[model samples]
Target: MTTDAIASSFAQYVTESPTAFHAAAVARDQLVAAGFTELSELDAWPTEAGAYVVVRDGAVIAWRLPESATATTPFRILGAHTDSPGFRIKPNPGVRTGGWEQLNVEVYGGALLSTWFDRDLRIAGRVVDADGAVRLVSTDAVARIPNLAIHLDRGVNDGKEIDRQRHTLPVVGIDAAFGGTDVLDWLRGRVGEAVSWDLFLADTQAPARIGIDGAFLASGRMDNLTSVHAGLRGIIEAPADGDHVPVFAAFDHEEIGSSTPSGAGGPFLEDVLGRVQEGLGATRSEAARAFRASWLLSSDAGHLVHPNQPEKHDPTNRPRPGAGPLLKISANQRYMTEAKGEAVWAAACDAAGVTWQPFVNVNTIPGGSTIGPIAATRLGIPTIDIGVGLLSMHSVRELVHVDDLAALHGAVAAFLAG
Candidate 1:
């Protein structure tokens, strides 16, 4: 596909992926259409050379194997997360105050609570029924978190603190007698037969190409979905036959420290890699050797120096949108990028003819971590952190340059191909 087509495809993918479960499902469809066989973790894996995908609840691992590949062959792995920061619906979330029906919710990650105010919101997530059947549910815009009037809180001009339980509640409807059809009742209708569900509030706005020249793309979930899309595109564009086994892993639960079964900090990737080695006819010792030789490119979003707040970023390492992807580094090892990892990314960029930049947080300000450090520690692999520079991260919506996204895609494809 052309570069313009790639950007448009990515926007559509972001719009369709409201939850991690939905994102994984969309990726699975794409892999299957590309002739990848879906394998079961319970069943024995195939020992032949081909394309295959393995899926857990919300995580997916896809790879391509060459016929000549063996136990000792090194693997090229690209990693990203599927989940983003938002509001999650509680189990018993119904509340009626002052003749208005509201839904109680908690912050999922480090969300910008203020941006969520005065925005139309929808619901989407996995719902489980009494019969133990799981169903994915999405609804039209049904809630709004209207901000308080300036007259009511005149201190709004100053810094205003948001109380999670009080200020973040979204009003669904205004009803004095909210007896019959509450939030759960409405959810049941959409879920068909669901008894309970883990629902998340999502922005109803669609992704769009913004800016005067349309150089900027604005959308929700760009914090990490951009990396996820880039990784998948790289794998698809890569040659089927290569010296190393090319793997793409889109894990879930990174925003929350990645401690779950499908998270990067868990055993999911390790198990899948072990199975791949065994399927490729490797012994335990050879598998260990292969892992030592393998490398991981942990892709996520990095913060660019804000135009108005330049002091927030490191003076020497200022990343800007539209330049290129950044090699994220941290003195505290928040990112897994080391000297070897930096060389790996630099070579990839040079081969792809893409300009790359460096990113480091300010001395006094510590930045958030991604799946890079977590996965690197868990697998003991040489890993580098790379991402497109973003603005207004963890907000209801985020921004990125179209050129940066293209650069990221090119760099990742080159890395996987090499």
Candidate 2:
């Protein structure tokens, strides 16, 4: 449990994960390499205590089985999403103008669009070929989405919203980048040759430690990727304790209300949980009861109090970088926790030597939400939402405390073991 090792691992995760599919693939390989068996959502599961992985669409869920199981030993589940808000490519997205090549992209989530400009942008995602095999594709160099010149859009300095559908598309090629009909072919070549796939622009920058004390992590997609990596680690590091079964699930489409088949709003989890129970020889009624008795932690990144705008946060409940994991609370119930649920997880933080903070967004302005209450209500399980505090959430490059990486992993890993 060395900090340097965890920092290295966090940096590794940042480099490999530019898309949900790639992130899931990275975690899948790690779980498999760590001796976790892969499970198919379309197939029957083995009837033993072992590690398992499940993927539906781009979403993933992995876990370590308790040595033995009874109907009463409720499963301890940790939930995280792999999707982040970014520019997603559309059907026939190519467009050429002013000797520049670019692809039309739609912002997928509540992204901080301002930060995306003038940064290196590359593409990464799963390529589903005509023959039905899926291959991961990526472009790491010159991976930036260039912004409009300040001179061209002087009004940008004032108040104006850049229409995502019209403006803000990344310039992908050099001058004359979109010269001919071969643009699609060129893209296919850059990714995987002859591969028909969905690709989105991603920053090619690697995650690294920043600042004087080496206290910050400047990385892209830290919002849920951080949780995905930590959840993956927790699932991998779950102890051999015979008391609880630890489960980790990372779903896609969370950035867009999670309404798709692979999202938390769908049956991917329900289907897998049913199989998990059946594999352990539990009847349907027993499975239902077990789910009712279980508890879940919906792990996503929370907002650190912004240095420039500290007034935006609740004075007493604000979470700071390096302080530890944040307890996300919303009076609107955007998060899943109540007082008792928070207490249950806060105790885990206490045991892991991980400090905790509270997040109740400022009044009336409204705030973003997570997959916590979504899954809890769907499965009727007690759930709490918590995460590491970060600044510049949903930005191309986000920041957080270097030590909070290990602190979060340690907390989630410890909670799973419990």
Candidate 3:
């Protein structure tokens, strides 16, 4: 696909996926459109050659098995996370103070708190009603966290600290009756019924093509969503007739250490892969052998060289947007990309006619982790951490070179097809 086409599709994915559950739903739709059958975890497996998808809450695993596939066929898993840093509404969120109504929120991860102030924000997530039906809701901007004016805090120009509990509450309205059931009432109105659910606050602004010539993409949820979309598109577009089985796995809750039932640290991936192997009549030893030959690409967003703060990145391994997909590495094993894994990614890049750059955090600065290390350790599979370089990660909105997405798409497709 052209760079514009790739960027446009990614923007659409980001716009539609404000939460992990929604992202998995969108991935499910894409896989179904590509003729993949949905499988329930409780169902018995069929020993057949077909494309199938298994879902667990906000996580999804889609794979294509050819007729020639056997118990010992190696699996090529493309990994990405569906979650991002944001604010989730508290179960009892409504509060009244000074005659104004606000919602209590809990911070989900390491979010840039300052960027959230004075922006149009909306609530989106899955809502389960009284009758046990789940509904996805993405409402327009109905709340905002107004920052303290400069007149009230003259020291604001200087770096200011924000208390997560006290300072970040978003003001919803001036109604004093909004204390008890106000937030839920508003959501129920939008959902067309009374329902109990979990909700997250998101920026209402749509994704946009920025820069002078529309060279950059500015959007929220790009950190991992970019990888999610790229991997989904790559897996769908890759040739599926190869001996190695191709799998697309996107897990939720990576932003918060991936410890949930559907997170990478859980049994979702292992269970599905085990089922695939078992269906093929593989012994445990043979399955281990297959894992030894298997490889995974844990795709997430990497940091681009920031012009305003270049000192934060490693001087020797600075990554730039449009250079290519960034191969993330760390001596501390924060990233799963070791020398052998690097070699596999390099070959994929060469096959796809794409160049690549390396990303390493400066010695003084610590870096974050991804599902790469978690799944690699869990499954004992050789894995490399890969991503497109972007700026303002975890902020209300992030930026990435438009063409970088296309390069990432090419590299992932080549890796899956290789």
Residue-level lDDT tens digits of model 1 in 1-418? 6667878989999988899988888898888898899998999888888898988888888999998898899889999999999999997788888878889898998998899999999999998889887777788899999899999999998999889888899999865374545766666677787777878999999988899999899999998999989888888777788889999999999999999999999999999888888787799889878888999999999998899999888888889878999999988999989899999999999998899999988989888999998998899878999999999999999999899999999999999998
> How far off is residue 73 in model 3, in Å?
0.4
| CA shift of 351, model 1, Å | 1.7
Model 1 CA RMSD to the hidden true structure, in angstroms: 1.3
Report the C-alpha displacement of residue 326, candidate 2, in angstroms.
Answer: 0.5
Query: What's model 2's lDDT at 359?
Result: 86
Which of candidates 2 and 3 reaches a greater lDDT? 3
What lDDT score is found at residue 143 in candidate 2?
38
Poorest lDDT segment (10 consecutive residues) of candidate 1: 175-184
TM-score of 1: 0.97
Predicted candidate 3 versus true structure: per-residue lDDT over 156-234, tens digit per residue: 9998999999999998876556344466567668877646777899998999998888899999999889888978987
Off by over 4 Å in 1: 176-180
Cα error, residue 412 of model 2, in Å, equals: 0.7
What number of backbone clashes does candidate 3 have, counting pairs of residues 3 or more apart or in separate chains? 0
- Among residues 3 or more apart in sequence or in different chains, the pairs in candidate 2 whose N, CA or C atoms overlap within 3 Å are 99-176, 120-143, 120-144, 121-143, 121-144, 122-143
